[model samples]
Target: MPIIDTHCHLDNIQYQDDVDTVIQTALNEGIEAILIPGADPKDLPRAKMLAEKYPEVYFAAGVHPYDCENYDLDILKTYITHPKCIAVGECGLDYFRLPEDEIEKAENIALQKKIFIDQINFAKDVKKPLIVHIRDASDDSKTILMQHNAKEVGGVLHCFNASEHLLPLSEHNFYFSVGGVITFKNAKKLVDILPKIPLNKLIVETDGPYLTPHPFRGTRNEPKYTNNVVTKISEILSMSKSEVSKLTTENAKKLFKEFDIKN
Candidate 1:
């Protein structure tokens, strides 16, 4: 079963010096494709180049929430139209790194939300699925997206962190994606919810260069570890690892059909 990493940042500096080796390793482990998102302007070109150079790689172009101080939506829209770009995101609300001062907190979040909304609009215009990256702001993110009528070809809440409150987003055509965190010791809640979530609406990712699975939590994360995540999620859902990989790969392909990735 070939796994698809739906949210790995292969263009990041963490893998810049060894991209060829990192990608080769993922192939060695049966990781067939990856969605490499450009979180910052400086990394956008890299994301495109990597996707173009590698047949199995695709790009998601957007400016991340944390770095939304001075964003240019027009440029984002322009760059995202490149043939290699398949989605618009890795963008969403992030309260984890907000300023310590209480007064500035609201402003920071507001700015992030504004940027997120703009990107959502861009996604709608381009008709490409979105890739959300919510961090400690799920409720707000859901509220805003819902209010804006996000159902217009809704996307996935990638690398989901909580399982208690399933983000009833499918009504909006959205799906939830899981990653290495589900394989952690303290993820019993997620494990319990795994079997409950609709399989067709579920997708798996690695978010590589970060969130490495349990067995290699402290080690540098890479796409090759996507297998461990698939194994863990499959066990939680009482299915074979191959089954999980197959479904998730299909889900990823359906979401990013522009790439023509055959599962």
Candidate 2:
């Protein structure tokens, strides 16, 4: 069975020097499709360019929480409709790295919420699914997603952090993605919760150049490593690697309807 890397940042600087080689390597590894998520407005064009260069590649358009400070929703909207632009994020609340000062932290949270909500609306408007990135702000992320009726379009909780509280989101059209992190020896939290994730709602990703799996721990991550994630999921769920690959790829295609899966 073929695999789809549901989330990756091929546009990141780490892959700049040999992106083609990286992409070809994944393809050679049976990765049939690759989705490059939008993290910053500046990276949008590069992402789109890659999508154009590779028929099997797709991209999303939204500002990440870290870049929310100067985000202009209108500017991001321009690329959301592109045929290769498959989703609306890599966007959501991230309070994990906020300031220590109370006032600054509060301000950062408020800005993140505002930008995240706006992008949620944009996804609804464009009639596309989302590519959410939540970290240390599950409550607010859940509240805002619920309040905004984000369930209407659905999305993937990218690189899911194993918060079972968010499991209810499976019914709300939110799928969960497991990344290379699940392969870590200390990923007991995620491993414990892996089985709870609905089979149909589980997708696989690499979050490349970050969260590189065990053995490759300190090395630069790439899309080819997605197979390692699938292997780990197989071991955890007691399923064959091919089965995990097929189901996860189907789940991804189900969410990203724009991608007509030939497999």
Write the residue-wise lDDT of candidate 1 on 97-154 in tens digits: 8898888987888789889998888888888888888878878888888887777968
Against the true structure, what is each candidate's TM-score? 0.95, 0.98
lDDT: which candidate is best? Answer: 2
Clashing pairs in 2: none
Give the Å shift of residue 197 in candidate 2. 0.4
RMSD of 1: 1.5
Residue 168's C-alpha lDDT in candidate 2? 93
Give the Å error, residue 42, model 1: 1.3
Screening candidate 1 with a backbone cut-off below 3 angstroms (N, C-alpha, C), the clashing residue pairs are none
